[model samples]
Target: MKETPIIAAGLHDTRSLAQRIRGQALRMVTRAKASHIGSALSIADIVAVLYGRALRVSPAAPRHPERDRFILSKGHACVAIYAALAETGFIDGSLLETYGADGSMLMAHISHKVPGAEFSTGALGHGLPFGTGKAMAAKLRGESWRTVVLTSDGEWGEGSNWEAALFAAHHGLDNLVCIIDYNKLQSLKSVDETLRLEPLHSKFEAFGWAVREVDGHDHEALTKLLEGSPWEAGKPMMLIAHTIKGKGVSFMENKVEWHYRNPTPELLDAALAEIEGACGNA
Candidate 1:
């Protein structure tokens, strides 16, 4: 394993951390010629906030019994969380170089084998159900820890997600929180073209969840909302984070092609430069 510089910063540095996540994911996808760079970019800030301030987890004690659980339902965007894990010390940054290579734990999709990843979820609709079960278990065990599941806007098409929503509400699982990365783009087209999820907030409300919407890139708002989950007692929290696809990279923003398009070598250089310039060389 090759040793690389790690950014071992505290909570206050989440903005910089988000930039690093984007830069890291960009490079990883570029190296492997993998897909879903856009998906990963869309949720970079959200993931950064989760690891930086919201999650009650420790890299040194990744499997601590009392730690909060976070599941990424949009597992195709694994690079973002992988980057977060590396940056925050849950795993060595060097392992990132092996990403998408043969037999690496860092699969294209998120996997539980990776440190700090609570669940392995590549199939669209499984994350919420699994996370809901975990939340229910916590409630039954009288544990104070919370369960957070981040799903893609496009994933709302999965009937299983709705089933999990109803189950969570029926059980009054306030400790459960679900965040949607509403980037409005899916694998090959706009989410509206693929499947309309309008009145998304109202849909969650009907399912008995406490709903809130925010700009996904706003670090302050994201941290505040995520850290202060379960906005209402006896209700699951549904936060719809409206975000732009392919965020941070000038050429890729909101362009659906990026969903399956890996950045070319020249594009990778430009993307890294933009990300590093935005966050600085520090």
Candidate 2:
């Protein structure tokens, strides 16, 4: 893997990159016979916006001391991260072919073994806590680096995330940013049918965090929201991004069954074709 340096300051069209990410993710899942295609598809645009514009990271120096930190709290949707890393040049694109193969660093779950991955997370409710610690450390050291944790809305039911939220709010960790993929679908069922998190807006307010809601698939909106972060100067930021499960592919959109379904060869072709058209228009 010949890693190349990335110029963090340059801007790119993330909307276009999002299509590529989704395409790569679909292919990865289908090839590996892995699951979570819906989960990965849901966050494609959000990840695109971050890697395309908001995040300050370097592909060559994966451990760039001053780079921004991103944690995929919703790690089941890791194919998106893998795609983003390859898209952003953090790792060789060819390495993605090893996904889900035995002995490959690209395990079924997100792994810290990957070059740009900050933490290995599969169990629910772990990413936020680990990210909180990283954010706290940055604050104590007076570092300018920001810690962004991308979590699934379903994970909100976990007590650990709430505790981490409390810690982030109390300490005034303005550098901490959490983006929840509120796709409204959990693994086996819909979030509403499982653990309802209605009035989600007010809940964050009550927790002492600055909150905002946006369309998770809107790359422009995501970029704008991220650029104007620390929404309140003294609190952490919570962006409740409303997204659709199995977004993009017509057959998969909003279908809960897609949570664990891998695309067959025919389905993969259709998905990739849809993404290809989207990329052209993007």
Candidate 3:
């Protein structure tokens, strides 16, 4: 337990938490001259919902055996995870300032050494495979805690994930839930331009998984679907979350270049104002 009070009074809502996350990630990335702010922003709401009220985790004891495991397979966007952890009391809010600094636990990519991260991942295709193994292990041990893997839509192009998909279905790891951040933009270009993943829902269904699509930004819709989906027995769940590349910021929205661009000081000011305005609207 960090013992430091982090959550603001009257800030228990997931939407508010998400706004804080975007602001925090933008600052950390800009200070560190780091990339992936766009990647982090795209999934802020998803991660916010998870950390805000969905994940069964404890800040006081992060490794609690019964806690649900969350793996951010799209690790380049770890700024979102770090922010969520801090916002949820999993780590000292001040430690966020150390992000990407020398000797900082908050690496540019996800690090298990961080207080709440279950698995360290940066390579695109590794998160789902590892999470699948964890789900299988839990099943073998007859544990109830589920494993949720958040992956980039681009990673679906990886042959390894398909193999893992087959493995999970064969073993009936219904405890596994995979959320794809279908932002439609990869590192260099649009996903369609880099490697197409169209007909994505059918592909997962063919792999023997139950599938659903959701507006990745609609907090209510995401909460409903994420909280109640796996709608069947004998199969894993795959959620395709359609999202904009850089959500929340005016100029960055849907822009691929933001994938590798760090926010300038001026841009940071503008982005924070935009997010704050959104918070006011909410």
Candidate 4:
């Protein structure tokens, strides 16, 4: 499919935005002495594309009715989403420093208290169903708004996800889009070893969703897939975004240990350097 002119024009800027968010997320996690840095990095690009290019969100009026809805199913990775929201002007960037702090609005997981965030989610398997309900509501109201759900490959183990998947297909909620961060590694081990969700694409197809697999870190590809509406009529869409767990950092990429390890000051500096290099190249 040809790139829409609007999407093409924003591709570089969106990538730069994502890279910046990744850097900020890394710094936030490091400063907070928290974990999930790897998961946060894994979905940075996807979050950027959603907020920067695709999602119809109002910074000044985040609750705008016609606006699209986004649910971060893997809420542990919400640092990236929060960074994107701040960068997009939906919230204050200064608030990022308080992430995970006591009594802070930004918790370790997502919270609806944050403007632009549609739903608060940390428990796995909840986001997909919530998004499905939102999409169904939109459909019932004859609204054109879309609902996008972002989940990790690891979350597939939850039976709730499958139930929602089946429900969405049965209801033919065409406006719903599910993006899977297939970064290979989960918390304990690789996704393959954890549950063996191989042939993931076919599984979605079997559930009656139109499926497309793409490089999660490729901004242009993500933009095209999202904008193109690869799904058929009367079907939901699923994009399996194959990605690296710790994408931008050299030593952290594909390393399972980073899943729950807080980056040291030196490591944080190195990761920021890598992100800066990526920005320059973009």
Candidate 5:
């Protein structure tokens, strides 16, 4: 499939970009017989908006010191990040064909070995801490680059994230922005059943971070809030992005089984057709 076009200043049509991300991610997961397509789909729009418009990154310079850092804390959904990197020209899109296969740099989890990937993260609760440290480093250097961490809501159960939250707040790392994929589902069931994270917004606010919530699938809404980060001067930003697991497919949406199931060939075909139709109309 031909990739979407990115214009000057890294600005692109985010809606189209999002559609492509969804479609590409679906294809990747299916081709690789991988799990977490649900997880990947949920954050497709958020990742699309970041790479297409919000992030200050360049295909020509994947490790540009001044480039904005984007960490996928929920690294199990590596297909989404891989699709984004390929679409944005950070890696040869062809390499995505090797995902989940032996000898491939693209593993089941997000890896820093990938050109645009900053940190390898499969273990939950690690990305946020690394991101906080990156933000602090930039602050000490008086650099303007920002760190954006996209975390799964279920990872909140890990106490380490709370500690990182407190640290970011105490130091006033305003450049640190964490967007939670509050899809309300985890491995076997809903987050409420697994571990309650209600009043999640209030919890972040109490941690001394500026907090906001938005529909994660809404490309325009995500772009508006993400492009205008650090809404407060002295506080880090936490965006609660309400999302649907398996967002683009009818059978998979809100279905827990998809967390570990790859789509059948028929389901893959149907899903791709649906995504293509949606993007064509959009």
Candidate 6:
């Protein structure tokens, strides 16, 4: 097994981390004959940044009360999150080899049963409320911990999400932060064609939360956004992270067909090559 690097080395740029994890996730899914490659790729950078630099977790003590919480609302992309957890030393990296396999802890959806996962999530529009409840609990206990939820753009169509949005705003849960992976592509078609969520930033703002839009792939922007609180004193924060589906993969980018395709060996090799090149350049 490769040794985990020191967190302070400053060698692990979020983009490189995302690329590395995405490569691992690709291998995991391909070997398992699983799907959701595009969805996993879409949020890789954000997950990389969160687990690599922002999250407060202990690999040895994942249930530490003071630790920050991360809920993957877009749980179909658990491959990316699992890869991030492995890279961060929260789980044995080799365990990723069994991803999606029968009897494997690494399922296709997020599971709190995993060492680093804070909540079990897969159903769309469920994470916000769950994260809100956690944030509220922290506030009640006067803890400094924060709750962050990574949501999919397509999840905006769910009424449950809007209900949670309104509830979070009403309570002014400042410790809660929501990051939307705005890749603009859903399972069967483009988000615009399936259900237009245009003017997404405005929608969040109108709901009484603070809003910021940024390039989801840009690590620096993501780092800054994660570090700072943007919502009003009593409001929850929302970040509309503009991203590309199947980002960093040449043939998969913006191609909806890749959304559910298990990567063939040839495609996996090509994807790894691209990630290797990016890591080398970085």
Estimate TM-scores for all models. Answer: 0.95, 0.96, 0.94, 0.94, 0.96, 0.94
| Model 6 segments more than 4 A misplaced | 1-12, 228-231
* Best candidate according to lDDT: 1
Candidate 1 segments exceeding 4 Å error: 1-12
**Whole-model lDDT for model 2 versus the true structure?**
0.90
How many clashes (backbone N, Cα, C below 3 Å) per candidate? 0, 0, 0, 0, 0, 1
Task: Give lDDT: candidate 6, residue 109.
Answer: 91
Which residue pairs overlap in candidate 1's backbone? none
lDDT of 6 by residue, 1-282 (tens): 754432231235677688878898889889988888888888998888887777766665577676788999999899998998888778999999989888999888999989979888888989988999999898888888889999999998999899989988988888999999999988889898999998888888899998989999999888888874544688899989999998888888999988778888988898999878877887
Q: Write the per-residue lDDT of candidate 2 for residues 1-282, one digit (tens) a residue.
A: 864555374377887788889999998999999999999999999999998899888887889877888999888999999999998888899999999998999987899999999999999899888999999999999988898999998999999999999999999999999999999999888898999999999999999999999999987789888874578898999999999988889899989889988999999999899889767775
Q: Roughly what TM-score does model 5 have, to 2 decimal places?
A: 0.96
lDDT value for candidate 3? 0.88
Task: Kindly indicate the candidate among 2 and 6 with the higher lDDT.
Answer: 2
Q: Quantify all predictions' global Cα lDDT against the true fold.
A: 0.91, 0.90, 0.88, 0.89, 0.90, 0.86
lDDT ranking from best candidate downward? 1, 2, 5, 4, 3, 6
TM-score of 2: 0.96
Which window of 10 residues has the lowest lDDT sum in candidate 1?
Answer: 3-12
Instruction: Give lDDT tens digits, candidate 4, residues 59-123.
Output: 76687777788899999998999999899888999999999999999999999999989899999
Tens digit per residue, CA lDDT, model 1, 1-282: 743333222374788889989999999999999999999999999999999888888887787777889999999999999999999989999999889999999999999999899999899999999999999999999998899999999989999999999999999999999999999988878888989999898988998999999999998898889885479999999999999999999899999899998988999999988888877753
Task: Flag the better candidate by TM-score, 4 or 6.
Answer: 4
Worst-scoring 10-residue span by lDDT in model 5: 1-10
Pairwise TM-score winner, candidates 3 and 5: 5
> Which of the two, 4 or 5, has more lDDT?
5
Which portions of model 3 miss their true places by more than 4 Å?
A: 1-11
RMSD of each: 4.4, 2.5, 3.5, 4.7, 4.0, 3.8
